[model samples]
Target: MPIKSIKKARKLIREKRKCVNASQWFCQISLAFFLAAILTNQLAYAFFDIAFLGELSTALQQAKVVWNVLMYFIPGLLMILAATALVMAGINGVVAFCYKQQLASLKRGEG
Candidate 1:
């Protein structure tokens, strides 16, 4: 993947977004959101635990209580994570389909 020469680097720069296509980028972003949402739930609890305490189990329980009360907007954070994941999956599927369509069009020289 490394540039073999300055010419190749210049060619890449000139290409800009001519590589992959926009729908592919959208699919990548949706996949990233899916991962981020999963991490966010775990990270919320871990953040509080890291900020406090000497005992692991006890510290995690305290963190959970604080997180639940503070993040009550979601009622249960797991529910939020699940909803976000579902949305992400739906988006990813749409974008992936669009990307495939774009590729097909490119092959047909419709652009």
Candidate 2:
């Protein structure tokens, strides 16, 4: 029946909306991660001139080494994660567009 088809179309529209929402969240999170990565990378570069390196205790020196390693490593990981999220967001947007087109065709009695 036409009513049944309408209900199904409505459901599809709801699903499309959900996908849009998820895509938006992924984009926002990706932006946040990208910003964090940039900040972390800048921090790594900014603190390289340790004038008091010789005055630090052994533990402090070890801590500095760990900090340097992590600062360099975490940004690369964050960038990768951000790229993944952006890709997911793009996929979701594409899915939502597909749902929208399907709903449109259903409205035209094409499916």
Candidate 3:
């Protein structure tokens, strides 16, 4: 093919959106994990003051059901977010791979 023809060829391959989105998903997951750790650590210290902690400790110890449910809920939400991000990254990766293949075929004049 002529240089002009190649330059004018409009392949459907995404330039950056798919790769960028895939990386963003991974970045979101990483940020979520980091924030979760920081918040959990800060909450632990804040909840451990000798005077103020006593009340919550007593309540939590007495009310096992609520404490257990709350304990599970936060982690459950984080896990859900992580799972969703991972699925999105997978989808973007698949799309980018297909796009790459199509572009490669076009390069060889096979498309």
C-alpha RMSD of each candidate structure in angstroms: 11.0, 2.4, 4.4
lDDT for each residue of candidate 1 in 1-111, tens digit (9 for 90 to 100): 233444454544344333334435545655655566566656766766676556558767776677767654433554555566556556655655555565455446563
How would you encode candidate 3's per-residue C-alpha lDDT over 4-102 as one tens digit per residue? Answer: 536534435345365767667776885686578557645644554432444456566666555456555665666666667777777777777776776
* Highest lDDT model number: 2
Give stretches of model 2 more than 4 Å off: 51-65
lDDT of 1 at 75: 32
Q: Looking at candidate 3, what is the lDDT of residue 73?
A: 68
Ranking by TM-score: 2, 3, 1
lDDT of each: 0.55, 0.90, 0.62
**Every model's TM-score:** 0.34, 0.83, 0.60
lDDT of 1 at 99: 51
